[model samples]
Target: MKRPDCPSSSHLSSTTPNAGRTWEEIVADKQRTDAAKIPPEWVLPPAVVAGAEARRSLVGAFIEGLLDAETCRITDMDVPDLVGLMESGAFTAVQVTTAFCRRAAVVHQLTRNMLEIGFNNALKRAAELDDYFRAHNKLIGPLHGIPFTLKDQFHIKGLETCMAFVGWIGTFEGNKGTGKEREFESEIIKEFHRLGAIPIGKASCSPETSNNILGYLWSPHNQQLSSGGSSGGEAVMQALKGSAFGVGTDIGGSVSMPASFNGVFSLKPSSGRISMKDVANTGPGQQIMPTVAGIMGRSVTTLRLVLKSLLSTEPWLQDPYVVPLPWRELEDCCPGKGLAKSKPTFGFMENDGIVIPHPPVQRALGLVKRALQEAGYETIDWGPPSNLESLQIHGHIARGDGCPDVWRALQLSGEPEVPQISGLFEPDGPRDPMSLPEYQDVVVHMRDYRNRYQEYWMSTAGLTKTGRPVDVFISPVTATAGLLPEKFFHAEYTNSTNVLDFPTVVIPVTFVDKDIDVGDPNFKPITETDAINMAAYDASAYHGAPAAVQVVGRRLSEEKVLAMAELVVEALSLCKAKGHGPSSVG
Candidate 1:
């Protein structure tokens, strides 16, 4: 009081504006200046840091002791097993849903993987299924109370699809005046609801699962590495068994890369296979290489169930963009049946001959090759049109128009551009838009690339043991086991599929082992990027990263992709039996 009686020079000095700041403004300025500093790459996002603080506030002291054997057991069941339990009346939907919800809550506390929690609604829906089962004495559908999560881009009724945009927090697509706030629903989400699937929550997502709101999504298997982006949150959820299955979208390798990095199975079907209506998109105007919905889970069976169930709903009717094609119970294309032989020939591309796969991936390719050889399948070395061609077409059509839409969406919330997307812009703002003429050239290139790719694929007939075109081709999903943040140098593996509009199934075949997966120094690099990529390899750093291969089939040939993926999985299982290397658990 005595100091204040002198009109406190300290308070006066604080009030004295440097330019125009008031006393409170000066305090806020300092706080914001401190807050604006970016975190180290290795550190989790501030939001994740805050989640840990929140959990501590709520749980007090017992959170550490709570992770015991029984808790883990309940969390390990896959979608099919959970559905089997519910169908047999061994467990009601309510019981299964409650277990997963509790486990998911714990996972979110540890990993900050969830962006929205629909626990109350999910439990209520589960109870309804239990009652329906009691009355009908039959399961509702194949999924029947299966718990799952989706990337925040999917619109779920009663939940806001903020999709990590601060501007999208309070409204539909960041528009406050739009009356459709929580009322809109995505077409694929509608299919899930109709299939008796329960939505546990929404997952965090970003360029690589890093954003201002949700921060970084860490791989639950190994926290030191990234979860893989755009779909990283979905992959992490599946890795931790936070959900029985998860859904994410891919334009480039978003789904496959994340699924591979997290040691899970995923299917990135061609566009129109799964409807994307009402889903939030990055570049809505650019439809050349449109993003497609994909499924990630612990097993191929889970993926099959989701795909079959959705197709049964006739998604094409509600979504005009969806193809009217129904899921075909593919006639056995096995050699003795559809073909003249018992085993079909397959084209194999160990690497694109551009970027060489790392040691773990090379080992995985060898395992698959040996397995197929032992099983009596013809494996022809696949040499096709350069994927470098797809690289050029992918950038122009995918990121052309300077990504003005992505920039505008980011601006709505005043959220800073994530470091992953920082390069998309100039120091000032997004780079100049691609001119109309230039953009057209890219489209033409993409079309030509597809034509040449198909021609090359058909050319496999001459190389096959059976005079038929190779059933499917196998290749690495990425050159590296898991990417170091921003270290991804090649997309030829995945982008080639997009360019060809081919269907692909990603099967995790092995994991990185520092002991056996050391790169050979004598190995010659095919191109400069290949040499640079090899130089970036460190055995210890990549240890435990999942190694996967892509089973690629012709456009609309999902059946063949799934079947061939099953064959690859079986072949690898046989190889593991011979005591050759690491095994694929999924």
Candidate 2:
């Protein structure tokens, strides 16, 4: 079991040799000379392959010949097809689960996306489902035997929820003697378990999915680019089909931004739709704008399936914070109903008009507008109030408590904060907690902003051909497709939705293209921040990054948001076929 390249205990007699080597020296030596020290099953090739070795470590060799022909064939199958196979006995749960696990193993070796490996546990559960079906002649549930991964933040029964903090490696949230370490489960975990979805493992995450545990999470679509953080790991996993679906948490744009950045779909509901109970948080005390669990997946239908099944468990009964309302089947919101009966009006806001979207993002928006118009959907220019209001409101409420809770958690181990979260604190400690009056003032401002936004939304009724309020307003998810480190300037696209408490569905509409996405010649700066954000735009660096739009709905109206998202997708498809301007996923 001794690796050739790695030093064995037998070789380190008395540990008197090379003990003074620096950490960087040790790591560099391992990377360059200790090839055998690398785990064979985890090395991923840079390219996609129709077949590859299931048990090899060489990235290129593995992907070039990674799986049994049958497994490789089934691995590329989508969710609905996989479900059909399960229902018809075309494949057993073991077969499907094994294929995905192997594929996931490869993905991890290549991307280092997973934090834990629960393939054995997942296969065991899959076998149990097979037994249940044999005994009762029924599917376990809608997501029967489906393999999925979660953001490391979710605690599973037998796995650790490290959330990428090294301090939390052995103890429960960095504490020992806690009985709940592996015994406890997140609310979402419970629901997924009941739905017969097995967790193959947990994915890596940075503050933007750029944490220390797994290093940088790169987009499978383009390894040279970032996967998008917070949920970057989950997004990459889904992009590579390492899981049937994946879960992530979004406070600002954690979930949506990654999904957009990695060319996947995600739903970031308003606070109460999904449960966050029993989940670890950095600053749990700041409950004003709480982080909610969101789903990321290959398709919108899969995301819907996960959400609908979670709702079936009636999570509200167990978690008091969960909304009591069940998932209302909105036949009224269906395209054939509200959307088809009228040329639904869409309020189009290209940019917040604060920080302008980069060329690729702008091109993506233009595509969406033309698609909607071609599909007989009315498009109106959306000129809303200053996004600067939410910019002010976000930081105050999101981190105003001085992040004492976050500080305490970090102190669990004497670990340095990751590069991504370094800006959250000063050299001394977390910033001072805002006073109660100032905090209350921010909250008041948030409330006023919401009412004014709603008023503006309603005012669109006068301008629309349908003479009704805009069905859904479309806007960029972020000012750019993928962010380069701390280049982000405007969070208004996402923060404004949070301030308004509106349901927002992020739809990946395009990729950053170096050739087509050029700088705007007539672009004018709206403010200092706007200028800085624009200046950070690099067409080449951003190439292949996914750009997406958010479909904003009224508070807690998830059904409507999803429905409109589908319609938008359909319209975009048609427009693309007809050779119109940029269509969805440009």
Candidate 3:
């Protein structure tokens, strides 16, 4: 599977060479080649791009105005409807591919969110899918002609994965002369190909790189705010409908936070639920708390379909680290799945006990709670092991090595550490790695916390009418309505999920309404962090940003979590009908 026409390095021209070039020269050349990939006709005028930058939001009318009617209609569709139309010949594969690529070109041009662009290769593959369907009178697979984006860490064929490190610009993960460069692909890429999903491009990865390649990627929903954690680029792409869905990696809130911030649905499955094989990573040796691939899309159904489609390929056979579990029909508690009569009772989180969520996040959590109660489902307060315990264990397990490898990657090209991640290292170099005994102590603490949490979860069976544990618990995805630079507060809820290895789904509930969601006059701080966090909440600063909640199921319970997420969505819809749910706009 050699990636033809995929240059290992972006050539300056027929006359120029890369030898002895400065890192600046290499970076400039890559950006030039990437922008050149978009068709000239699709490029927006400078004035339009400038106007978009000046605006507070890039979605809705501003972006839709740039696309033609047909492009708008095509790109607006979710994954399932796109596949159905492609299967029925109502739209050719090339049509859908071109629509998304056109919109993606606009997205990258406006936000600088693309690390690599592969529009030509994607169009060629879309034509091939159309050929297969014409010859066989059926879709090539369930995801036929669907376009998707990934965080730049994935090794997509026909795309160079620099992962935003300048030292990695012209090599296979910082090594030169490797024939596998740009030719190698991840396990999930192979599964996607088999299902006929096309890769349009790679999105920005990390470090809020306004100074680097994908310049200043921020929230598409509200440009005033930070997009989110590391998965911000992919989340913005989904928010703007650049593709049908997207894939990202999350160790803590990397995926969930951005999805929540941008107002989209995301599933961060427990490690081993999805394939992570051959993906580039910063801490490759950190397996005690393994990283997981997360899916972000327009709806819970799309997330479920994407995961189930991957599982159908039996990914466990290739990636042994992936669990051997297939999609469990019995576990899906969707309507008509025979569990309707026994609707799942939900656990509700008023607060995580360390830091309180912002007014908007608090409202989102309460809305979900009331929605469920109004829809005939039982809701109970959820209290488990303290998030502070998970916080300590997560730091050691995730970066106990002091992130020497991350520091080395930056030093490879002398790229200064961005302010976002500068805290991970000392002024001069990485911190000392934890000793074996100390690291083991953290692992032991993690196990104990997990055991206690599980005991508390199981004990809920005693409090329910059905005498069963609450199916899944819902809580704030983050403490803020949207992430703003230097305005950090709480991550206990998200960090604890990784520490406990639970499958969690982020459901976008509402947006920050400065008019309605004002700070509580009697709000009492529970900790120093809480006091500082609440003090920073200015209503005008956070207006119109998305607020969301996350649903957590027990470990490896993705099926149940997703189904329960669908139920939450349905319950919200029920409340909306009753005029007691989310507002139409912030």
lDDT of each candidate versus the true structure: 0.77, 0.75, 0.86
- For model 1, residues 187-245, the per-residue Cα lDDT tens digits are 88888888899997888887778765656665554454577888999998887777889
> Which of 1 and 2 is ahead in lDDT?
1
What is the C-alpha lDDT profile of model 3 across 501-534, one tens digit per residue?
9999999988888998899999999999999999
lDDT by residue for model 2 over 1-586, one digit each (tens)?
1111211122211212133543234334423432332346544444442222221122223443655677667777767778888988888888899888887877776666777778778889999999998898888888888898988899998777778765566568867779988788988888888888889888888665665455666566545456777888898887777788888888788888888877788888888889999898777877888888888887666777788888999999989998897887766556644345445678888978678888888888888888888888888988877888988888888889777666665555444466567667877788888889999988888888888988988998899876899888999988888766655677789888877778888888877778888788788898788889888888877766678888888888888788888788878777778876453452
**Under the 3 Å rule for N, CA and C atoms, how many clashes does model 2 have?**
19
Estimate the TM-score of every prediction.
Answer: 0.87, 0.88, 0.95
Worst lDDT run of 10 residues, candidate 2, spans 1-10
- In candidate 1 the C-alpha lDDT for residue 483 amounts to 71
Candidate 3 wrongly placed segments (more than 4 Å): 1-19, 207-211, 336-339, 584-586
